[model samples]
Target: MTPDEPRSRLADLGVGPGAFTRGRHNAITDVSGVLVGHSTVHTDRLHTGVTAIVPAELGAERRWLPAGLAVGNGYGKLVGATQLQELGAVETPVLLTSTLSVYRVADALLGHMLEQPGYERTTTLNPVVGETNDGFLSDIRSRPLGDAHVSEALTAAAGGRVAEGSVGAGAGTVALGFKGGIGTSSREVPVGDGRYTIGALVQSNFSGTLSIAGVPMPADELVSAPPAETVGNSCMIVVATDAPLDARQLTRCARRAIFALRGVGSDFSQGSGDYAIAFSVGNGMPPADATLSPLLHATLDAVEEALINSILMATTQVHADGNRAHAIPLAAVHSRLAAAGVI
Candidate 1:
């Protein structure tokens, strides 16, 4: 069997870096009160869907999560980012979908928010939506992801182990010429008081050379690989933490996440629109600067693993239009990392 066929994430390889511990689920949902849901539409002609991340109860109208935005490259359409940057908070659930499907998802999310018990008569709510183009593998022009699909995901939101790869907004996405999708991981940072959990989720749809555990994917496998293509040029990162942090600290965590992206070989090309959004469920303000290193370090490591998990958990896919995206070969990747003394 080919390495790409393996069903596993980065931790399954036992080569991930960092000294921090992981949460029970090793997913973003490990952060208290965080929930993730996905609605995938993978058919012969259309392969796209929506993913919703909820940090609080749906009916809490006045309650909002402290959030921050960091743009690795400003080539994205993260709706409500201006407000998030200015106000440092998000009032509605976060949804991600195909590039062309973002608007519909946003509208549907707005409906869901307004319909929530406390939002009655609430004039305007900023819906946070992000996207990557799935045009190459799917008929993105068809805009198959609609309000109903978005509602399904919202309704399905729950906390626990999350489904990854080839699902949600990542259904038809490609990354680094490989089959890329939704991936998640978490890390727990120990402090003098108590350990805090930091979790990360990524919709990886950017292009770059695949690297695992600090080693480049071996070239021999690439030479024998089937043809693959990148449909989108962006990545969306969502980081959640149980630690008491304000929007400013979350923004710093996201900046560290961006640095972690480079560790996985992301080229950050001009066409790429990489963005990271981070939030905390706690109401307390950020900690002292000296004490924030653990959080930043935790974010860096988790983001790296989350990005790696996207390709590792993905399987090669063939689109109806004859375009294809190969999965990053896991066995070859492990072997290469071993040869490089990185594992």
Candidate 2:
């Protein structure tokens, strides 16, 4: 496909819908008041970039939102984890970038937040930044990102269709042996006289056996075998919702998001850093415990599709070091899924 060609998503392949209905954009931005943007650095040697997720409601007022985090594995440099866990809330927009560039991006994010109208007297801020290693396809040690990129992403944030695959923090990422990048999906659930939306965005860069709708891809059918070096990378999952969930409920939702990895065949290896952060933008009393089942189910479905979309929407990438990550063969995948009666 050409650079400008829109990549296909899970639904585009005729996959069946899950229990809940999907949101308009089928992205995290489907959750009202949430915006997403990316700043990509795609040079010959640098394939890394930064992505910003802004809860628009937190604008200049910088109001805190209920949030929770869950970790499947602990092999990453996720900034602001302890503080987020301790406070059970997030006060600034979340950022994602290359592994080594986490601290730099966090600093830039802090600067961006402090400059907001209401933070003039702010003394402390926990800038949540997440990362996955893009070293195989980028010169990661060079740390190519800066404040400009962070500002670009934050300023460009908007609520609409999100660009996925080989962009933003996922630009150089490898996942399930393929060129993994960014992917997103959202679902809407109905409660008592109201409805809520749960959306998931994933930076997929972990090792796994590729699976679609519970059907595993045969080894002989793969266009290319996963490289030995692609075995122990990480994945960052961000879940957003309009549900009036507290930190505890959001944490449960985040755990479900991480669990969705199993559906996509993630091994959750010792060296892999698998993490999920969930936040809510809605303000009101949360639904009862019984009503949360559908939300949790929606989280699982959205995250699973998001992971698959990360692989499907990505384009092949090559690094300055002569290493390469190939995009999954779409035709072969379609045939495999069709033959398995999955589509």
Candidate 3:
């Protein structure tokens, strides 16, 4: 889209992102010190790539950040998970990529981290890598993804507006029976001492009845156009905040955020491996009861909107092999939401 042209995002279409104040960039990167980057492989040979989230600057002294993992379903590969769970900290950048490339990305991440200024004697480093299958529209067996793509993503990661939809790990992903990909949003909530921010990034590839603000799509249309078995299979959600919290608290926050998926009509199919990972970067005390409630609510709003953004921002793409994924029609969604008085 051109600078003078309008983009098709939920807010632009009058869809709500919940009852919270948005961050400056209205993205996950709005959280302090968080940076995002993507490397999209769109050639005929490869329709996949990587999206990287750098919690802190690569050369920053504080390499580790407090984090937690919430497994909505345990049916996919997530490297560094074991150590992350055991230590409740993440020392390296988080990488999101296609399912089969998780290993290669992890290997690349390790190499990248080791080369950092202070990792000279580091014998072991945990690289957080999450993924979802994108083999339906793209040729997965090609294995075209590699360290170079990882390097590119990591190299460009920066704190600002994150590029969304049909990019990086979400390049070939399908969601809610439509084109789904990388999406992000952020919100600011009031805490006891002050305010904290909650940001979300989603890789949506799961399918179910399509609903927006409790208005389900015409049941007949969904039945007639059921989700292609090869797509709409899983999702990866990442939550970031500048608040001070340990892994356990973040895990709880992640669990609470999953409800947003249900609000958007996710059936959590057997093949849909829904996972949410949360982390905090600041040094303040944990949020109080009142503050946590609003934070959780705002997170749900951000997650729901982010997931929708993934679909809205993507464009319908046809693969060389003839497979195709259609983008959700934004004009149609706006009309429906308006009729239901949800906008």
Q: Candidate 3 at residue 254, lDDT? A: 89
Give the number of the best model, judged by TM-score. 2
Give the worst 10-residue stretch by lDDT in candidate 1. Answer: 218-227
N/CA/C clash count, model 3: 0
Off by over 4 Å in 3: 1-7, 57-60, 218-232
Global Cα RMSD, each model: 2.1, 1.8, 2.8
Better candidate by lDDT, 1 or 3: 1
Tell me how far the alpha carbon of residue 149 in candidate 1 is from the true structure, in angstroms, after superposition: 0.9
Q: Global CA lDDT of candidate 2, please?
A: 0.88
TM-score, each model? 0.95, 0.96, 0.93
Tell me model 1's lDDT, rounded to 2 decimals.
0.82
Candidate 2 has what TM-score?
Answer: 0.96
Q: Give the range where candidate 3 is weakest over 10 consecutive residues by summed lDDT.
A: 1-10
lDDT by residue for model 1 (1-343), tens:
1235657877777775478888788999999989999999877777789999988643564467888899999887888889989998888888989998888888888887788786677897899999988887898887887778988898898999988888899888888777888999999897546679999999998877777766777333553665456655889999998887888888998889888788887888888889999988865556787888888988988988888888788776667767777777677777777788877
| Model 1: colliding residue pairs | none
CA-lDDT, candidates in order: 0.82, 0.88, 0.81
lDDT per residue for candidate 3 within 232-299, as digits (tens), equals 37889999998887788888788877778887778898877788888888786676665577777888
Alpha carbon deviation, residue 145, candidate 1 (Å): 0.9
